[model samples]
Target: MALELIKGNTAVAEAAMRAGLVSYFGYPITPQTELLEHLSARMPELGRAFVQAESELGAINMVYGAACTGLRTMTSSSSPGVSLMQEGISYISGTELPAVIVDVVRGGPGLGNIAPSQADYTQIVHGGGHGEYHLIVLAPASVQEAVDLTGMAFDLAEKYRMVVCLLLDGFLGQMMEPVVMPDFQPVRTTPPEWAVGSPDSKERVVLTSINIDPPNQEQFNVKMMTRWEEVEKNEVRYKGYYLDDAEYVVIGYGTAGRIALTAVRAAREQGHKIGLLRPISLSPFPTRAVDELADRVKGFLVVEMSNGQMLDDVVSIAARRVPVDFYGRMGGMVPYPDEIANAIIEMIQGEHDVNADGRAKWLAKMRELVGTGE
Candidate 1:
């Protein structure tokens, strides 16, 4: 197929359409409004359902409703908007409904800004909503990756009967790149037996998060945890770059991962044995891979657009086997390749402490570089 230059948001919308998305409900939010706009025109043209919801809450519930009927349903939002949908997301997860949610993350704490940021890492990966539930979070680093992962999100959501999240930075969502779109896959015409509208179903299908009996709720929670374990074992995905002779590894995801790659290459050219580990799935975070690399690498440098949210995960997996350091640019700011390369060099050469002191030092340096006062 010929590649077309498309914005990340448009690519995801197009990919979902081709992947047989039957229903879409979303509210317009910066860095991801294009996705909703694209689907509004495309879905109805294809005779599928599309709704510009009253709000994020309305949108997520609409997704929940569509998904209950065993339809391919999705919603997109930025950080603040996603916050509004958390309750609905939790309900969907508790009910074991399959759905896709795209979070084109921007700067955040509260309506932080519409610019690019990776601040939503903890919210999306760690439960954004209340419950003992896990979301299958796929972090795509590029426009093409966004397209591919969006399709994969739908398939995985159905296969596991869980919510799948496509987490991307706002930069990726707004930027344009060449993407080879996937071929159209046939939509599921026959609903599953558990679906609300299954044909000739004598029993009424009830989907709800409520479990009045304590024992039954405990049992349901156990089942959810068991399924999460399965996902962790089978679904962890990551890409290793120049890891063979690497003495130092840089870990990141989404747009930050892509930038880290450039830094890795630059450091390699400067005769440093630097490598990169990019986590594709944030939920089932490639902990095993990091553990394996910990034995070989001297230390780790975690790069992120947020204030080291994912760095916490890296530190847990590395387990102080090798020192884990961090450099971050929060509030929608992006770090440059040279900045990352320099950090890699510093991590390798400096005999830094692998504790809170080390993190403080690194953060101080980052603040200095970004001209933020202590």
Candidate 2:
């Protein structure tokens, strides 16, 4: 291919299909509904399994059963819908099955509007489901990036035998961008040896999360911890801009990071030694990379569409080695580049230390600009 203009949701769906997605089960929800709608028609057209389950709860279980066969399986939904699927997500994790979950986040604590939000940061990145489990979370800022990540998600899920979430907000899901689609991959129809059915195996294979004895459960948990160490070592990902000689750094992810880039560029033209670090993987968060910046930069500015979710992560990583300021918008609000640029400038001019009240400062700014957003 040639590059084609497409919406983010549709691009991800098509890319997953190309990546040999054999089964999809989901309930429609705003922002992400387009993804389900696209797959509903296409999956069956290709002789793959596609089901519009009765509810989000039902949809996730369908994905779980399909995944037991060790084929490429997935489901997508927005914030509220994802909340409904939490138990199923935990079950898939407990069973150590591979599944890709696309979470196009929307505003919410409960039934919030269909507007874009990053509020689900702690929810998804920190494991919204019950019990001890690790999820590889990938956040993409553009339609092209979302498409690229979609294929990668399936591969990673199987590689780790765990759930992988492709997380982005409504803005990215509904926005249009040009993308170079990936090539179609060979779909696997037969079950893996560890899965429910495998004729070659002499003994019957059983798959379940249940470990009745306490010592047995502890042993299983220890194995998961060892696997997570491998994931942390190999999967940390991030992107940097103008960092070589920069003195001040900004940290963010997904759409927030993309917007921060525009602000950083503007600051560059103004002779400010500022840069941006956008984390592509939220879980195994670029911890060491950020720690290095804490030593290298004069300060760090944390930005987000949520009220300081990722900011807390940066703050903990930086550990007051450098003063960290924050800027954010909540309830589906998105901060403008100029607002972030202004934050960068304030960060440079002020004598604030690591103990500075970032929320208070951000609230002050918000108070002054309440009626000014365009």
Candidate 3:
């Protein structure tokens, strides 16, 4: 495979096509509009279904409809647009329809900015919509990763019969990097038996999120939970760097993780014992790996582009056994590697009281940085 300089969004779009994506429906949103644009030209030329939806709501529902027919389908949008698609996402989850959603997150509380940010960490990973469902969220840190994971998203979605979100920040989406595209797979023309229209089927197939019967719905929920557990057990993915003898660790994902890697390398070169734990699968979250490292490391620092959204997960996995600190730059601010290195150094040199007081102090310091404390 020849390497080509490709933008992250373009890489993702092309990767989806190679993965046999038969249908694509999306509305343009910044940092992600190029993905839809690429698909707009390519999908039509390939005779695949492509639609420039009226709105995000329409796009997601279109995904739902296509997915019901057992076609590999996907939709992409930015943060605000993603918010509008939550209801449809929830519905897709409830029905156990397989589909891919790419969230090229920008700064946001509500239409905050068009720059890169990981603010949607909690929203996409922790369930953006009303439900007990979980999205198999994959956070790619590079353009190559964006390409690889976008291709994998289709397989995972079908394998688990669940929604898969390729969560990337705007920086990753817009940035260009050398990527070797994956080889194409042949598209499946035969619809699965569970699909709405099966030519060999003698009976009609209906897909719906609603189950009026209380006991039946309860049973359905149990089945969903069981499947989720299976996903958690088998699908957790992450990358650990310099953990063998490191006294301090930094945790992050996506663009934040990519930045943290640079910081970790620099800190290592400076004789500061720092390492990185980067989660590739955000939902399963590499909990076991974190727990194992927690026993070895002196303390942990969570770096993100949001107000410690992923920090909560890191803390929980650490289980208060080690002191955990958080540093983030919200609303489109990207942290420099030096700044993150400094944060890690401070964490290592600061108090080691994993007690309530130490935790409180750490929170206080973080709050001060964000100007949320008095």
Candidate 4:
């Protein structure tokens, strides 16, 4: 198949259209602005609905309405813009609305900058809104990855009857690379039997999470937990590099993982045994994969562009079975491969203290949460 060089944001928009999204509602934000612009110019020719919503909140609600009518819908934004959509995302999760959200992340505590950052990992995977629900978050490390994952996200969203988030960073969104888009298709949707407002309302039903009864809320939590377990069982996804006989592993996701690969290569050349564990699905988290590596590796160094949010999972998974250390560069800063290589070398050489006890306590807590308490 022939490939065309395209920017990540443009590739994502093209892939979304090729995947047959008929309704798009979004507010433009840096890094992802090109995607919306592309869609705005092209979707009309395909007879689709594309709205530059008044606000992120309005955009998400528009998606909710379109999704309720059984259309494949999408929205794109950066970190601060995404924050505004949280309430709508939460509501959609409670109602099990099938939609795809693209977050080309920029730095943030609040509108920090328009540079790439993985600071939103905690928010995306651990529920950014006021609920006990999880979005299936996919981290794309490159332009092609961004495109491919966008298509996969829409499919998974419909199949699971859930919200799916494509978590990319500004670097990936702006970088240009060759990609082969899938053949275009007309939009087709089969509303879940449980979807609300169908003509056969007496036979089917509408359900929301706004439970007034205490038992009902408890039941909702239990039900959502069950769904999450099912997701972990079937959907935890990751990629490993240079892991054979390594004494230490470097863990990362999204664009950070792409940069970490360079460190892995350099470390290997220096005769330092280091591996990379890159999780594609942040929500399901690829926990078991990390656990398997934990039994083999002596230690792990988690590197990210945030204040160690994902490092928590690495610590919990490795437990006392191995040492775990964290390193990060926040506020849109990205660590160079040399820096990461040095960190891995330090971890393996025992130059820095690794938290075995903290890892042990975290493991116990995770075990309790997952009902596998040891």
Candidate 5:
């Protein structure tokens, strides 16, 4: 395995091309434009179709059309641009299309900035697009993880007959790091019988979410829930470091997870029993794994680039089982490991400020600042 220094965004594009993706439809957006640019320039040599769509919506619709043909396809954009594609994403999810969407998240709510942010946690992980559906969301912390997981996204999307998204942020996408490319192997995709261009196709297939009849819509929703349950069971991925004899666990994902790992190492040197729990899969959110950790650890500390969106998942899993502390930086601010280490030390020494209501009052103050009212 030869390693080369590459930015995370470029790695994703390279992986897609190497993995036999012949169709690329995307619109230019900050932090992720390099990916589209990379594919646009390189894909033509492979005789692949690369289009710079007029808008995010147009780009996703192109993906929809190509995916309906049962060929490997992909699209990418940042948070705001991804928001534009949600309606199309929901339709794609409803029809069980096999496609990959890369979301290099920036600060949000509206054209926030061109900085790294984990603010899309609630949107991507909680089914951002309106519908009774979920997209398999993978969060990668490094350039290597970004490339490797983008390849996995395509595989999982084909296997599940659904959409899969690689969720990273500007930091991971823009920062250069050493990445080893996987061996070039052909992508093997077995399209379902219901797919439009399948061999046995004898009639046109309609892919839409519009089931106007109430009872039929209810039935479809139930079926979707069943699939989600299976996803929860089999698809959760996380990495546990230094957890063997730890008293506190630090939970994070994407770039924040890497920071948390550094903090864990620092705490170990200081003789603090802190470990790191890094979620690789964000949607099928490794909740049960987190709950299991509660049995051993005294508490869980949730850290993120946003104001505790992922922390909510941690709190849900840790409820009544163990104490969960939350720390976050908002508006696209990134935190250093020293800050995380300090927070862990404070928690270990029982130095966190708890309100009279026994709630972490800082959480309430943070929500107030973010105006989330949580």
Candidate 6:
């Protein structure tokens, strides 16, 4: 295939199609509607299934149904829309179905702006739905990354018989980048042994999330835990830059991470020995790598488009070994590279106190930036 300039959502849609996606069920939501629009025309042309459901709730249930046949299936939505699909997401998890979800996150406590925000980090990565189930979540920082991860999302979902999500903020979804997409994969003609409606199995196959018997539910829960352990062992992924010898580290994911790259590079050029750790797999987070960095680095700075959500996660990993500071822009606001650059300079120069209140300190900086000098 040739490299083509593609928008993030279109690239993801096309990548999923070529990855042998058997069905795609989703609703139209900003930053991700392009994905559905592209699949609507492409899926049917390839003789695959494509349904734009009435709502996010309706779409997720449709994905659940398609996945029951052991088919490669998926759905995409923005932040608020994904929230609406929570119930269906939990049901799919309880059923242990392999289905893909694409979340092009927008800003929100409620119907926030159409602009990009990484606030969904905790939502998708931490399993917002009501359940003990775990999702295989991938965060992408570019259109190309989104394309690659979308393909992987399906395989990861099927590989573990668990839900997988491509979690990119609205910025990545709308951005355009050049990418050489992969060729089409072989289609699945037969259902898995556990799936319903398999002709090869003469015996009846019943696929259901309903475990009316408490013991049965408990058994399945234990099985999920074992499978999640496998995921943690095998699926952790991240990208590091300039970390071979660094006094401080900056951590972010998706758009925030992409922007942080600029800040980190600019800081390095100005003689600051800093690096970045961008986690590709948000869930099953790169904990070991983080633990190692905390042991070596003088301090750490966590940046995000949300109000220090992932900061808490990194703080937990650091365990007070070194100071971990936070800088963020929330409610669809994105931080400038210079602002993050300035934050990095501050962290490296300030008292590297182990118990410093980074969020409170960052909040003060934000207040000054937004506050009028009256």
Candidate 5 Cα errors over 4 Å, as ranges: 187-192, 351-360, 363-374
- List lDDT for all candidates, in order: 0.91, 0.92, 0.91, 0.84, 0.85, 0.91
Clash pairs of candidate 5?
none
lDDT of 4 by residue, 1-374 (tens): 89999999999999999999988999989989999999999889888899999999999999988777666899999999999999999998888778999998888898699998888888888888996888999998888888888889998888777899999988899999998878886677545456565654458665565788989888987887898789889988889998888788899898788888999999899888788989999888988888998887788888788878898888777776787876676778787888778777767876434445433433454355445534
User: Worst lDDT window (10 residues) for model 2?
Assistant: 365-374
> Cα lDDT for residue 131, model 1?
72
Clashing pairs in 2: none
Clashing pairs in 4: none
For all predicted structures, in order, the TM-scores are 0.97, 0.97, 0.96, 0.91, 0.93, 0.97
Residue runs of model 3 more than 4 Å from their true location after superposition: 356-374
lDDT of 6 by residue, 254-280 (tens): 889999999999999998899999999
Off by over 4 Å in 6: 371-374
Q: Would you give me the overall lDDT of model 6?
A: 0.91
lDDT of 1 by residue, 215-315 (tens): 99999999999999999989999899998998989999989999989999988998998889999999999999999999988899999999888988988
Report the candidate with higher TM-score, 3 versus 5. Answer: 3
Q: How much is 62 displaced in model 3, in angstroms?
A: 0.3
lDDT of 3 at 203: 86
Q: Please report, as a residue range, the 10-residue window in candidate 6 with the lowest summed lDDT.
A: 365-374
Output the lDDT of residue 274, model 3.
84
Clashes of 2: 0
Report the C-alpha lDDT of model 2 over 175-254, residue by residue, as the tens digit.
99999999999999988888888665578988888999989988999999899899999999899999999999999899
Q: Can you give the lDDT of residue 370 in candidate 1?
A: 66
Clashing pairs in 3: none
Over 17-135, each residue of candidate 5 has an lDDT whose tens digit, in order, gives: 88779699999999999999999998897777999999999999999988887788999999999989998899998877889999999986688999999998888888778868998
